[model samples]
Target: MFILTLSETECRKMLADNRLARLACAKGKQPYVVPIYYAYAGDHLYAFSLPGRKIEWMRENPLVSVLVEECGHGEEWRSVIVDGRFEELPDRIGHKRERDRAWSLLSRHADWWEPGDLKPVTPPLSKYEPEVFFRISIDRLSGRAAKAA
Candidate 1:
């Protein structure tokens, strides 16, 4: 399939429609990639993680990369790649708010939080304070789209 560069408007549209992305982080010698739920607001992307692998990695190395992609039959596809530096928000209240916002976007695109699903809703900050909530201020963003021939 041939690739076509996407306009900023087109990239944002796809970003709004999809919430799951692959996040890449490196710590000196090792690199890690993980699936994460994210929300795009203005020029920043936000995500929340419990005290786990991703959080540990990010703490050690704040530089990260992310990829969001959509593919269909034939050559129909779109993808966006982002490179940025991550910042862990220090305010608990603001972190919780941003986490909820990110989860809302994820719920819209994926079944991670179906209305009647047996899964527990993400607890509010008052209940289960996330270990960390971070924002990635994008330094570079590139997107491509390809239509079926």
Candidate 2:
């Protein structure tokens, strides 16, 4: 098999094409990862979630990473890793424009609100749990593609 590094343009193209990624964040020595749907725009990834563990951890430490991957037939695969900082868009006057932008970008997908909108049945959350809109400002992008030799 052969593994090749993807260029900046290739990496960005992949990000733009994909909708789901594994979002990772760290607090002190502990790291957390979860699957999230996002919209790629300019140099940031816009996503939505409830006030949960990831939201809390990211607020405490803005540094985060995302992994997007695609697998094809016969051992062909590609993956990208993004290192970024998270910035929340609250429901306020100052962030209205950005919040709208996030909505507009994400709304293009048919099921954009799935999983994020889902709530746990047993461990019920508060009815007042606020929806969170945030962006991961991309700092770096690295990717690799593997193909059968």
Candidate 3:
């Protein structure tokens, strides 16, 4: 098998073609990673999530990373990594345009709402808070692919 580096275009294409990814954040050297769904548009990746540990950590430290991967049979696979800055899309003034864009982008996918908006249904809870919107402004994107010779 052989491994090759992917160009910026290829990396962006991989990110665009995939929706599920792993987002990594850190708080005082303790790194946390979780699977997330995102929409890639322009130079940013948009997502939805509730206020939680990851949100808190990202708020404290805007630097973050996202990983997207594709796997094929027989040792054929590829992965893309994005190092970016996380920024929340508040509903308040001065961010309406961005918020709208994020919504538009996220709405493009049918499974977009599954990641962060899911609520427990087994016990039947009455109160479940809505998810907030955020985006990662990509600073760098890299990718690698392996194919059997």
TM-score of each: 0.73, 0.96, 0.92
Per-residue lDDT, model 2, residue 102, is 97
Give a tens-digit lDDT track for model 1, residues 1-149.
67799887887777777778899998888889878777788788877666566677888888999999998777698899889989886556756666666556444555543221222446633455444557788888889988765
Q: Top lDDT: which candidate number?
A: 2
lDDT for each residue of candidate 2 in 18-84, tens digit (9 for 90 to 100): 9999999999999999999999999999999988889999999999999999998899999999999
Sorted on lDDT, highest at the top, how do the candidates line up? 2, 3, 1
Residues 1-149 of candidate 3 have per-residue lDDT tens digits of 99999999999999889999999999998999999999999899999987778899999999999999999888999999999999999998999999999999999878777768765458755677656899999999999999999
> Where in model 2 is the C-alpha error above 4 Å?
none
| lDDT of all predictions | 0.74, 0.95, 0.91
Among all windows of 10 consecutive residues in model 2, the one with the lowest summed lDDT is 117-126
> lDDT, candidate 2, residue 75?
96
Off by over 4 Å in 1: 92-130
Model 1 clashes, total count: 0
* lDDT-better candidate, 1 vs 3: 3
- Please report how far candidate 2 places residue 112 from its true position, in Å: 0.8
For model 3, state the Cα shift of residue 51 in Å: 1.1
Better of 1 and 3 by TM-score: 3
Better of 1 and 2 by lDDT: 2
